[model samples]
Target: MSDGIDDAKRALRAELRERRQLLSDQARTTAEEGVHRQLDALLARTDVRSISCFLSTPTEPGTRSFVNAAIERGIRVLLPVTRIDGLLDWTVATPDGDVTDGLFGLPEPVGELLGPIAVNDVDLLVIPAAAVDHRGMRLGWGRGYFDKTLGSMERCPPVYAVIYDSELIDEVPRDVHDQPVSGVVTPTQTIVLSPQRH
Candidate 1:
């Protein structure tokens, strides 16, 4: 990554973090509800039997309701379990299961890991992103966890980034290793991005 692009990304991440933190309680609830409705409708049309998803933190676009609903529909939902080496392990999450505290303030699953390559078992992947551009470029939290995971997959599924509507912009600063997603899901809509080659 060039120093200029790296600097811009740092600034953008900070700005987005502040925006999330400033959301009011009422606004947050409304957004979560909206996301739930949109996501539920999106899932109804897909034949995905298994999914790889992250357990959202408070400020992120909500996924808890979707996860529970998927499980209820007999879909297998795998949640990421962060490892000491910065790679993520997969674990099956049940609606009633407990989420214990994990690294970087993340809530993690309670079972033995299915290992990093376990992600390949999923039919679809819904990942976290600070911002995703119209060109499908995803700007993640500085750590290269998701990028590395996506890069290592031998036969990757369609990966979608979950973000607020406003976070889907014209462009975001990118590094050589930055991974692009196939689509983006916001509170109001699911956008299918055109394919981009590295």
Candidate 2:
């Protein structure tokens, strides 16, 4: 049974990877615009003091607009920095500043590592996922980065996994280490789930 489940997950991941790669430039732009609009709405509803988000990559759903908007709102913006111990550390970033490339070529803020902030200090956490289920289970890029990071947090923040609308699924294969999200923000809508169930 386990083997069959693993096989199914592998196949699904491959198919989704292909689809992500085939996204046309125009489609990518439209998706990004939609994400920005949703994020704007979220920001307006919440009195977020600080946010932790990622820098965008071509294949990954981008968060540049969200980060910029946070900066413009005078909200403290934090980005993840890869530690030598293979852990993700949070650091503050400016609107127009340089960032350094880290694991998997992900860009991170170029500044003093504020180290791990109190998870409660982060009002919102923008998570990156390849796909997410209606139950809020996230299928990451299989790096286990976010899983490990969240596990280490003293008090986990409200996590919002960002994805394209089409990437939302009814269910997903999950392991013991997989952490569920509090909500999911898609290009089309925001689906809130019960708190994280590890």
| TM-score per candidate, chains pooled | 0.96, 0.91
Candidate 1, which ten residues in sequence have the lowest lDDT sum? 36-45
How does model 2 score by TM-score? 0.91
- Weakest 10 consecutive residues of candidate 2 by summed lDDT: 112-121
Model 1, 1-198: lDDT tens per residue?
899999999999999999999988887787778777776776776788898888889999888888888899998999999888989999998886788998877778788789999999898899999999999999998988999999889999989899998999889998888888999999888999984858
Instruction: Name model 2 segments beyond 4 Å from true.
Output: 1-7, 118-120
Q: What shift in Å separates residue 81 of candidate 1 from its native position after superposition? A: 0.8
Residue 160, candidate 2: Cα error in Å is 0.4
Candidate with the greatest lDDT versus the true structure: 1
